[model samples]
Every structure is written in structure tokens, then in C-alpha cells.
Target: MTSLRFTSRTTSDGVVERDFTVGEVPGVLWSPAAGPDHAPVVLMGHGGGLHKKTPAQRARAVDTVTRWGFHVVAIDAPGHGERPLSAEDEQVRDEFKQAMKTGDIERFRKVSVGYALSLAERAVPEWQRTLDAVQELPEIGTEAPIGYGGGISLGTAIGIPLVAADSRISAAIFGGGFFAYEEELAAARHITVPVLFLLPWDDQYVDRQDGLELFDAFASKEKTLHANPGDHRTIRWHGVDDGFLARHLG
Candidate 1:
């Protein structure tokens, strides 16, 4: 099992942010400046083309730490953020850009799906290893409950598989923005933990029915679907049961 190596630390607004690495994977942990040991931990995933600490993600992480008093952790996905992008990753990205420039929707979908799956394949184990390191910390020992605090799109794509494979995760929050691939649906089928699925009623690239289908695929007997009218970027989440994770984790 790999251990976390603290690389930097900063504090603001009663939240302490620590940058760390689990072997080669760079990640950030946000926690309340003052909190009990073994508090619940939420593993947050960023959207496609975004890094671990984007403004939106940081705000959400801070809220999770301050509002729920739970620790929040996020990591750079493969070839994203501070991680070095491989030549193959660069080529796939170039193909993706060309497809978008040429108005090739099918090519764009194909390229995006392939790239997302590849990233997810590398990320799931990275997350598990990260969990292993996080549990070793005295403040968030092995007994701390875990939840997937989703970022939609690429986040949901990777999180579906992570929650399915890791029994340590007690609950999850997922949203729709990216295409729902078959493998994602398959992964959702294995998840029996409580779930909250957020759907953008209208998305520019992904079909709304696909999101519905992905929600339907979840085997969780306790699952809720919340929909709002807008695309992923413009959607405002309202009336969500923010206590869902706290209830399950505690």
C-alpha cells in the first residue's frame, strides 16, 4: 500500500487544504480547521478538462468541509492537471479537437468515450490506493465513512465504476453531462449503495434519455433522481436533499 506524502498546506475560512501525493497521483484534501478524528470523507471527482482544484470544485470542497464538517479529497485524473500527458493522450486530444472543429459529432463522441474510458481505467485503482493512504492518516482513519462527491460528466463516468468496485463507499452523488457508455451502465448495475442522481434536463452533447437510462441501471434500491432544466454548465441544483450523504455516512 502506498502512503501519502504531504507536498504543501494552506488555510483559509476555517478550512485547511493539504496537497499530497499517493505515489505518482497528486491530490488535495480539504478539512475543517478544527474537527474530530475519523470524520466522514467525501472523494470528489472533477469534470472533464478540469483539474482537481477548479474554482467550482474548490468551493464545493470547502462547503463539504465547513457545512458538513466532513473531509473532502480530490485527485488529478490521468493526464489531467499537474500530471504529465502522454503522447497518446495528446494525440487523442488532437483528434477530439479536430472532430469538434469539423462538426463531426459521431467522431467527437467516439473520441470522448474512448478517452474517458481510458482515464477511468487508470483512475479507479488510483482512487483505491488514495483511500488506502487517506485511511492511514490519524484524522481520517479506516473507520471514517466514505462517499463519492461527484462533479458530473467525467466525474460520474469514473465514479460509477469506483463506487461499484469499492465496498468502502457507503453512498454516492452522480450527475449527467457526458455520454453514458455501456460499461458505465454495467458498473452502475453492480452498485447497491444509496445514490443520488442529478440530471440536466437538456444537455448539448448527451441525450437526456441516456441519463435516465443510466439512472435506471443503478441497482441501488435506495436511489433518487433529481432533474433541472438546463445543460450541464447552466444547470442550477435546487431542492436536492443535501443531507443525503450525511445521513448515509453517519
Candidate 2:
């Protein structure tokens, strides 16, 4: 087992928590030590089954972004982070249950992803308040816009909506954005930010046509796709590099 460690500090109104739980989600708020006034900000999300651990996995990504003068708020999604199990929080739990009952994995996915989207939407009001209060950046009202957002596979739940709702988000990076809501929500069509998508061409789990269609339908002219030649889980190993980030993010 990995021994977890965190160091806490305070802001003005509420206690600033490191390895904190704004609600049920596990999160860490990292701020620029020197320039609280002039830093950019990012709201990052984690993938399915992996919570904020993947952010920890991407240590270079986290360290580099913070050094580049952006405050980072990395959050665990509904089920993954510091949340409690409740019958009331049955949407995701139930979706998992229903899928287990029927063994219809695809239906299970839609329900699961949909449930996370609902929770993410519900959580945004409080999250926005956190952004204003904890980070204490230059323009709380107009902090040069949120620069980048992303997650591995399942974190697209939050990433998709954030891109859809806010024009302020400038760039989005997603890996294994597998599910495409063709009927309910057009995932790719709505994103306004320059999107960088990383996926494997041989992914056995994702619907290949749907994935291609979404990539094809990307509404932003700045959108681009990278394909790795492996099953779904190999992108992190074979797909991207630091040079890729430098070219895209800078």
C-alpha cells in the first residue's frame, strides 16, 4: 500500500485543505507560492476506478503546470475520491448494480457516465466558490480564464460539461474519451475549446465508429486527435510524451 501524505494550510474564510474533501471528492489545491496574484488556474479530473491517484501518476503534469504559474485543483470524481457510500447517492451505485445484474456492459457505461455528469453539474456551484475563495488569485471575477482541463478515460464526464458551459476554458486534453452520447448529448459537437484527444486505435472497449465520428465531429477547428496502436490501457505508455505537452499546451 502507498502511504499517503498531505500538508494543510488556511485561506481567509474557510480552512484551505490539502488532500481535502470539498464534499465527497478527494482533492488537492496547489497554489503558486510566490505569485498568488498573477497565476492561471486549472480544474483537473480523474478517470474511472482511479480517482485522484492518476493525477498523482502524472506527477510531471501536475508539477509542470504549477511551475508555469497556474494553480491546480485536482479532484476525485463522484465515486473515486473521498466520498462516502450512501443509498441516497444511488445513481452511480445503482448504475453499477444494474449493470452487474444484467451483464450489459454498454448500457452500464451510459448510466455510469451520465450519473457522474449529473454529480459534476451539481458540484460546480460549490467548486466555483472554492476557486474564488481558496486560490486568492488576481481577478476573482476575471482571472484570465481557466487555461486547461482534462482527465483519463472516465474523467471526461466533468471535462465535457466544463467545456460546454464555460467559454473561458481555453484548452482541453482528454485521453480515452470513450463514450459518445449520440442521442442525449453530443459530446464532441459542443466543446468550444481547442481539444487534444488521445486514444488508441485498437481499443477493444470503445465503439470505434462512434469514437471516430466524435473525433470527426469535433466542433472546434483547433481540435486534433492522436492514436496509439494498442488496446485501451496503453495510451499512457505509448501515446504521449513531454514534447507533446510542450507543443500543445504552450
Candidate 3:
């Protein structure tokens, strides 16, 4: 069991942000400056090329802490952000660049799906270990309810497996930005928790039907599909239940 070591802390706008490491995985946790113990914890995942604390992600984390009094934590995925890239990471990055440069859509999908699969394999256990360490904190004991605060692209790719493998997460939010393979669908089948699946109705690189199909794969009896027009980058989520997590996890 890896223990989280807090390395730094900062506070602003009624939110407290702390940087910590569990073994080699670097993570950031945001909480209300003065909050009750055993608050619901939300695990937020960053997109493919982004680190855990991107401006947008940080904003969301702060909002979650402020509005819902939920602690939000995000970690640098394997070979991403503060973590050094391994040989496989470098190779896949090169492949992605070459495929995009040469306008090879098939090659792009192939390499990206393979890389997403590899990253998810490494990330699931990292998240479980993170939960283990996080639960040890006095403020957030083992009784804290947990949820995955999802994102599009690589975030969803890795999150699906984590939620499937970890029973602690009682509800999850996922989005579509990457190509879905059979394994992802299989994992989805195991997730009995309530899910909110977001889909960009007009993703240029990924077919819209793929998102629909992936949404269908979820075994959650209570799942909502929220589709917004535009690609993943330009999406403006509206009309969806902002209270979804609060309703389920509260």
C-alpha cells in the first residue's frame, strides 16, 4: 500500500490545493479551505496531452470543491506531465505525429487506440493505489464516498477501466474523444454504477456513432447520454443535469 506524501500546499478563493505523491505518481488535491471530514471525493482525470492541473481542469476542481464541498484529485498519468516519458511513450508520440503529419487517419486511430490501451493498463492500478493513500488521510477516511469526475479523450479511456476495477467508485462521468475498442466496451459492461456519458456530436477525428455505440455498452441501469454539438475541443455542455453527481454521490 503506497502512502501519499504531501509535498506542498496553497490556498486561494476558499479552496485549498495540495500536491502529493503516492510512490512515483504525482497528484494534486483540491478541497474547500474549511470543510467537513469524510467529504465525497472526486477523481478527475486529464486529457491525453494535458497534465493533471491544466487551467480548465483546475477550474473545474475548484468549482467542485466550492460548490459541492467535494475533494477533487487528479494525477499525472504514466509518462505524462511531470513523469518522464518511457520508450513506448516516445514511440507512440512519434507515431501520432507522423500519422497526423502524413494525414493518415487509419494509422492515427491504430496508434492512438494501442497507446490508450497501454496507458489504461498502467493507470488503473495507479488510481487504486491513489485511492488507498487518499483514504488514509484523517480528513478523508476510508468512509469517504468516491466518484470519477471524467473528461473526454484519454481521460475517458483510462477512467473506464479504473471504475470497472475499483468498487469504491459508486458513480462516474465519461465522455468520448478517442476510438473505442472491444476491451473498453467489455469493461463498461462491468460498471453497474450510475454513469453520465457525454458525447461530442460532431467529432472530426472520431465518428459520432462510435460515441453512441460506446454509450450503449455501459451496463449501468441508470445512465444518461448527453450529446452536444461540436467537436470535443469546442463543446459547450448545456441542458445536461449539472446535479448528476450531487444526486448520486451526495
Candidate 4:
């Protein structure tokens, strides 16, 4: 696999930031330049505890999505970057981290699910911000089939925290986002949209079976799940079997 080199060229070169409003919650947008008018809009987030746009995902935004004629936007989730994690949230996270470090997988799962759900409930501002992030795209307003999505681990974990009722994202692709089955089914009961999911075997981040179980809930006929070899990060960059990606994304 080739390691990506960041130059003052295409990848980060196309990057630009702007602010937009979603209801009352304001959000910042990072739009990377794609060739021209692409149909479905793809939104992205960096891994948890990271900035909005990590180099790897950002590189994929340009190399994979932008090159494929899909407009890409990556944003820092609430409490990430300039956003501040609440004191309660920080304490919870610290305690949760201790549990995980102790190799208590069951406890980790339980705490994570509860934490994520609580976070989502408390994320009224973040939801509005997500809506605003899309509304304030570089291309601005354009009625189109929106593809809301993200990557492995927390980046693309589940669409629950990222989506609001007003969101019009039609086609979403979750690449290696290890979705928890019960959590996804719970959050996606009302979500009726075409979603595309790619899960990798041996991915330690998110459970594979769980991801598939979640994907199965999509009422839309267009939703699908693909399981293959390669770790979480590899399937993302190194020769992403984009053969299926191009068709679904378009």
C-alpha cells in the first residue's frame, strides 16, 4: 500500500471552510473541491477524539469521493475541535476509557451504548449544526439526492447522532463504521433512506455482525451491506473496491 503524501495540491488544496445555520445550532463546513456539480452530497467526520478532517479520511474524500464526482464535506462533531466537551462528558469519557482499558468488553459495550444514546439526546445543538453544515456547503443550496455518511470507528459509527428529522440525506454509505446492532435498530426505526454499508472482517473497532444487523433494518430496497477481508483502515484507502462504490454513490 502506498502512503499518501500531502502537498499544496488537490487533496487539502481543495479545502475551504464556511459557517452555516441549521435551525438555531450553527455549524462549520469544510468543503473539498470536486470537479463539477455532483448529485448526492456526502458528509464526513473524523474519528472520535480527533479533528473534523483527518489526513487519511480527508485524502479519501478527495481521492475516492471527489474523484468519483461526489461532493464531500467533513465536519468536527460537537465537542471536537473548537467545540468543547462538557465537564460531565469528559468525566464520563474518562471513566468509560478506564473500563475499556481494563478489557471489560461487556462493560465497554454497555457504557458506550448508554453514553452514545445520552449524547445523542443531549445533542440538539449538534443536530442543528449538522443540518447547518450541509445547508452552508460551498455550492450552497441545490436540491439533490443527499448521501450522508462517514468512516470507521466513531466517524461513521451510526447515522443516529448525525441526522435530524429535517435532514434530506437519501443515500448514505458507512465505510467500516462498526455499528452496534441494537443501537442502530433503535435509532433507525424511523429512518427510511437508502444506505450503503461496507464492513471489514477482523476489524476490531466496530463489530461486523452488529453492522450487518443494523444494515438489515433499512426499509429502502437500495440499502446493502458488503463484508470482506482487510482491516478497517485498509478497505478505506488502499484500493477501495470502488467498483460497487461508484454505482451506489452516483
Candidate 5:
């Protein structure tokens, strides 16, 4: 386990938001100022182009701590957030934007998946290292149950592999991501834990069939797919039941 250093601030709502470094990775941990001695922890991942402190991430963190009574943690994916982008990363980003602007679905799909897969490869290992570091924190508790939750392209790309590899993660809320790469689909087969998969019926980036195929690939005996009518970004904020997480993970 890598060593961790933490810096925290108290929100007006009384949640403690701690920023920490686990080796070279930057992450945030959120918890209620007062909670159970050993609250379960949820490891969250942000969408592509977004960082750990994005509005959605912050809202989910606060909701989980105050409403769900769980601690929340999130890390910046490689070349994202505080991490500087490499030349190759910049090129990929430019190409993806161009593809989107030109309405080149094929080009967009190819480049987007490639970019997501590359990030996933690096992000999963960092998440594991982060788990190692966070589990050692006295406030987090070593034996508490851990759940993985995140969405969109990068979050799903990285999270599928992380959940497949880590037995400590007992449940997951997978949203806004699809089976963009073979490795991500393959990883799903190993994820037998309970999963709540959210699908955006009108998602622009992901084909509905592809999302269904990915959901079916999960080895989990208990998995639920909640598909709502909306595009990718809209689905992120709507048409999802919050209580599902508490029910499955609690």
C-alpha cells in the first residue's frame, strides 16, 4: 500500500471533504461530520473530461454521506483533473472533438472507445492502489463493506475492470457507459457482485443494443437495468432512483 497524505475542509452542510494524495494520484474522500464508527465506503469515478470535484461528483458525494450514510471517495483518472495531459492525450482529445463536430459516428465511436480504453488501463491500477491507501485510514475502517459507483465513458471503462478484479467491492452502480472495448466487456463476466446498471435509452454515444449486451455480460446473479428515455448527459441527472443504491448496498 502506498502512503497517503490528507487535507480536509468542512462544508457548510457539515460534511468533511478531504483531499488526499495516494502516491501520485489525487483523490477526495467525503464523510459526515458525525456517523457510524465504521461506515461503508463508496468508491466513485468521474466521467471523461471531468475531474473529482465536478458538480455531479460533489452532489453524489454529499448525498451519499448525508442521506445514505456512506463515505464517498473519488480519484482523477490519468491525464484528467490535476494530472497533466500528455501529447498523445491531447491529440486523442482533438480527434474526438473533431469527430463529434463532423457528426462522424463511426470515427467518434472508434476514437472514443480507444481513448476510454487507454485511460481504463491506467485508471484501474490507480484505483486499486487508492483502495489500499484508503482502507488503512482509521476513519474509513478496514473491514467495512465497499461499493463502486460511477458513470459515463471513463467511469464505466475504468470501473468495470476495478470491480472485476477487486472482491472487496460488493455492489456497484454502473451508468452512462457501454461496452466500448473488448476488454471492458470481458471484465464484466467476472463481476458477479450485485449491480445496478443505468442505461440512457437515447444515448448518443452508446448504442442501446450495446448497452444491453454489456448488461447481459455481467455474471452477477443479481443485476438490474433501469433504462430511461434521455440522452447521455440528461440521463446523468434524471430518471434514476437514488434509493436503489441504499437498498442494494445497505
Candidate 6:
């Protein structure tokens, strides 16, 4: 792993928050000052149009670190957060929006799937590099059990491939996302870790059947689907309880 440079600050509650640069990727790490050396760790990814410092992402990280005494790490996804979008990516985004506006599900799916797959190709490797850098930090113990969590389309798109390829992650929370493409489904089949999948039955962007199908694709012997009534944005606030994360990752 390459050398990492980080700046840290401690909150009143003794939780340490660090901002780091691993090569070109920007990330955040949260750890309890007095937590055990071998405490569990969680790797999280933010939703589309969000960054590592997003309120929802930070809240989850703080909860895990302060309440559960776990180490939490999150990184910005490509073309989001600090990463600027390329002209090609911007064009694709515009195309996706137009497709959605026209209610052209086929075109929407095509553009979305293509863009997601491309991002995943870069994202998975970047996450692995971040993990390598994080493990070298003194606050995060070596060989700690790692859990992965994320929400929305970009999160799912990268996470499915990431969890499938990386054996270090023992469990995962996949929510507010769906698999409408062959590559994503193929990637899902490789994830055998315990997974808690959340689906909003009335999600505007994701079909309920598509979400269920994505969950079904997981080869995990221990997988649970929690579906609630609401749209994508609201359902996450309702379905993802503190206890759910505690049970799976704490």
C-alpha cells in the first residue's frame, strides 16, 4: 500500500474523525479513542450525488464508532463528491434524465446500467486500495471483521461488485437500490456473506420487483429482505433502524 496522509480531530465524545488521501481517493475514518484494538470495522459508501461527509453517511459512521465502538471508513465515488465528472459522463447523465422525463424505461435502464457498470469497474479497485491504506492505520486493527453498507443506485452498483470480489467483508446492508442489468446480477450471485437488503415498495426510481430480484440474486445462505411502504428517499429513514445495523455488524 502507498503511504497515506491524514488530518484528525477529536469530538467531545472521544470519537476521532480523520480525513485522508489515499493516492487520489479522498476518504474519512471514524474511530472511538478508547475502543479495543481488535474492534470491528465497517466500510461504507454514500448514495448518488452524495459524498463521504454527507449527513446520513456521517451519522451512520458516528453511530458505529461512538455507540458500537467500531471503526468506520467511507470514500467518495468517482464522478461524485470531490471527483469531477468527465464530459462523457455528463452527457450520459443528461441522457438518463431525458429518458426518465420521457418515461422511456428502456433507455433509462440502458444508460443507467452502462454508466453504473463503468463506475463499478473503477470503484471496486479504489475501495480495495482504501481498505489497504486503512488497515495500516493504528486506530483500525489488522484482521478486524469488516462490514459493508450503502444505499441507493450508485452505492449498490459499486457495492455488489466490491463485496463479491473482496472476502474481507463479512456482512452487508444493501438498500434503496436495484439490479436491472446482467452484470449486476452476475456480481450479486458471487456475494455469499450475510446480507440485510432494504427495499421501498413504492420507490419512484426502482421497481419493487427489481429490488426483490436483486436480493434474490444474492447467493448468501443468510439474507433477509425488509420492505417498507414509502418512496426511495423516505423508506431508508424508516427501514434502516439502529438495531438492524447493530445486529448485523455490531
For candidate 4, lDDT tens digit of each residue in 94-151?
A: 8789877998877777777766666555453454455454544445445544566666
Candidate 3 residue pairs that clash: none
The true-versus-predicted C-alpha distance at residue 43 of model 1, in Å, is 0.1
Candidate 3 ranges beyond 4 A from true positions: none
- In model 1, the clashing pairs are none
Worst 10 residues of 2 by lDDT: 9-18
Which numbered prediction scores highest in TM-score against the true structure? Answer: 3
**Alpha carbon lDDT of each predicted model:** 0.94, 0.58, 0.93, 0.57, 0.84, 0.81
Measured with C-alpha atoms, the lDDT of residue 221 in candidate 5 is 96
* Candidate 3 vs. true structure, TM-score: 0.98
TM-score of each: 0.97, 0.73, 0.98, 0.73, 0.93, 0.93
Where does candidate 2 clash, by residue pair?
Answer: 26-82
Best-fitting candidate, scored by lDDT: 1
Report the lDDT of model 6 for residue 56.
Answer: 79
- Number of backbone collisions per candidate: 0, 1, 0, 1, 0, 0
Task: Estimate the overall C-alpha local distance difference test score of candidate 4.
Answer: 0.57
Residue lDDT tens for model 3, 1-250? 8899999999999999999999999999999999789999999999999999999999999989999999999999999899999998999999999999998999999999999999999999999999999999999998889999889989999999999999999999999977988999999989999999999999989988788888999999999999989998898988978788888888
RMSD to the true structure for each prediction, in A, is 1.0, 6.5, 0.9, 6.9, 1.7, 1.8
Better of 1 and 4 by TM-score: 1
Q: What is the per-residue lDDT of model 6 for residues 127-148, given as tens digits with 9 covering 90 to 100? A: 9988887778765656677888
Candidate 5 accuracy as TM-score: 0.93
Identify the superior model by lDDT, candidate 3 or candidate 5.
Answer: 3
- Give per-residue lDDT, candidate 4, residue 69: 56
Q: Score candidate 2 by lDDT.
A: 0.58
Clashes of 6: 0
